[model samples]
Target: MDGVRFGEMQTSELVVSSRANARVKQLRAAFQGHARLSGGMVAIEGDHLLEEAWRSGMVLKTVFVSERRTVPGIVPRGVEVVRLTEEVFGSVVETQSPQGVAALMVPPVRVLADLFEGAGAALILIAAGVQDPGNLGTLVRSAEAFGANGVLTTPGTVSAWNQKALRASVGSLFRVPVVGVTASEVAELEGRGVRLIAAVGAEDSGVVAAREMDFTAVCAVMIGNEGSGLAAEWMEMCDARVTIPCPGPVESLNAAVAGSLLLYEASRQRAVSKVSGS
Candidate 1:
């Protein structure tokens, strides 16, 4: 497909064969948080993610395709496309089976207000100190699937833009409004009249069962760290604490599973309420 034509679209001037090349170095840096901050872009590997980014209207700064692959027509006009030697491309990307395409994109800028743009009795998911990128990504995907208005991450939570998180999100990251916030900022949700619900282990006594809570109210469900559970300060801020009923002997649900279940319950409650009203 090397001869594939783009009518009048412009192509990159040089083929990058060396891993030491400046552009290659820049791509490598984009994989790291600090480096991404310096470059102001994130590296998304594989053809699927690149396409997802494009479909979501993410600004593509540059596209890198491996020597063995064809440039996908999905790439927008005027975007710089760099062809890299297979060996060099492998060296620059994290995925073992590189889809022969990747792109450096400007991470979407989002504010707390964006989460509530059209929200009425909004459902928001808050990841508080959840360190696993995969878990965080799954929660983000579930957030969108279950009709969440948006997702917010606390200071200690992994950035949803992390490469592993991005991949695990299965492109939902692009579609969901995810923004980071500090502990102080989280307090603002309460001021906005949104109920803060804390999710705890099923073993925890004296907590309301997940399904028993009224999720039809404007609410944000907070999922805490995998190991330590929610911080004391966070729990204190919650309007109510809830636990998913576990019939098995397992100590607790996985963070992602727990969060997803809570979201599903919320969606169910909201749907029922709407139907009953109608």
Candidate 2:
């Protein structure tokens, strides 16, 4: 009896079984951008995103998995791992095709000062009143592809942390800084010597065409509401109002489309400047 080993410690202790566990509850909230649950962490789902987080050396807070998955690789040391049943995982996410893995990560905290934190940034996108998450997400991705320093959003804009936005971003949420700030704060960006370009549907002389602008200078391009466009105050603050010269039956470009086109033009200008050393 003294030598009997009935209760040897098992490695399975690392695995969690109950769906009602606090960690699972936290993960559920994190999926919805709850700061308390996420603890300043960015939630990412699917193997591809997890891989992206890993390869980027981002610190992971916890990893959640559905019942059917196998451990894919060596999780970083000190990171917590959670396993759940498929039903449990489904309840935690809004997706139909659950990839069975997710991670809570700490994204780099960026501020307005960080915009010029590095040398020679030419453009940034200010999503002033974009209400749709998908549109906001697309803007972020486009900003990155077009070499913008970051994407900033004013109050009343839909959250970039939104699940739909996260999916639409295709991981650009992690790649680019999407920070939310107040309209008053945005007005100050112009005073800081960051040229503010507001995109408006109608102006007296019409908005300057993207092709003729010099994006090689530090600037913040503002894209506003789908319905109302930029606020009157925001419009008044712009160094220039810019528009994409469109020749179509369409009244105007979608907010994301207009923003992306402008960003690409900015990128083109930057590229040309470097080539010609101007």
List lDDT for all candidates, in order.
0.87, 0.78
Please write out the lDDT profile of model 1 over residues 1-278, one tens digit for every residue: 23323232456444667777767788888876555443888889987898899999999988888888889999987887778888989998898788899888988888999888884688999999999999999999999899998899998998898889999899999989999998889987888889999999964566899889889999999999999989998998999999998888887889999999999999999999999999
Q: Give me the candidate number with maximum TM-score.
A: 1
Query: Cα lDDT of model 1 overall?
Result: 0.87
Clashing pairs in 1: none
Q: Number of clashing pairs, model 1?
A: 0
| Number of the predicted model whose lDDT against the real structure is largest | 1
Rate residue 178 of model 1 by lDDT. 95
Question: What is the per-residue lDDT of model 2 for residues 79-117, given as tens digits with 9 covering 90 to 100?
Answer: 666667678788787678889888777876767766666
Candidate 2 C-alpha error for residue 198, in Å: 0.9
Estimated TM-score per prediction?
A: 0.94, 0.89
Error of 2 at 138 (Å): 1.2
